[model samples]
Target: MRYPIETLGEALAEGIVTGHPAMPQFELTPPEINDLLSYLKSLE
Candidate 1:
């Protein structure tokens, strides 16, 4: 969460797929990303 919401949104929009074995590959819809960003920003 060190990154700004805009940067996080941009990254989320493209989807996230890590090579790490424990990480899950998935993409979030615009609304979902917005929800997540809201929750994250609440912590700030």
Candidate 2:
């Protein structure tokens, strides 16, 4: 479970200003978070 803390941090920061309704509020399990991070990192 290795999420890119930075990505979550950035999302939180951006959501603060944009007030995005899609922004998630709950904490994700380690595996789910890691999977998302892996997907995003691969896009780079």
Candidate 3:
């Protein structure tokens, strides 16, 4: 990961919105975000 997991989590919590054609904006609950972060961390 290029950034710290916390930073990634924060971004996810805030909802990722971009002007790009392919990317979609989305947000998750704190627990859902934490679960996702844990899964990503497990890959390492």
Candidates in order have lDDT scores of 0.83, 0.58, 0.82
Best by TM-score: 1
Compose the digit string of candidate 1's lDDT tens values, residues 1-44. 25577699988899655658798878899999999999998987
Report the C-alpha displacement of residue 31, candidate 3, in angstroms. Answer: 1.1
- Clash total of candidate 3: 0
Candidate number achieving the greatest lDDT relative to the actual structure = 1
Q: What lDDT does candidate 3 reach at residue 37?
A: 93
Q: Global lDDT for candidate 3?
A: 0.82
lDDT per residue as tens, model 3, 1-44: 26588698888877666768797667799999999999999998
Clashing pairs in 2: none
Model 1 error, position 24 (Å)? 1.6
Residue-level lDDT of model 2, residues 1-44, one tens digit each, is 33355667455344434357685555556677667767777897
**Each model's backbone clash number:** 0, 0, 0
Q: How accurate is candidate 1 locally (lDDT)?
A: 0.83
> Using TM-score as the measure, what is the rank order of every candidate, best first?
1, 3, 2
All candidates in order of lDDT, best leading: 1, 3, 2
Clashing pairs in 1: none
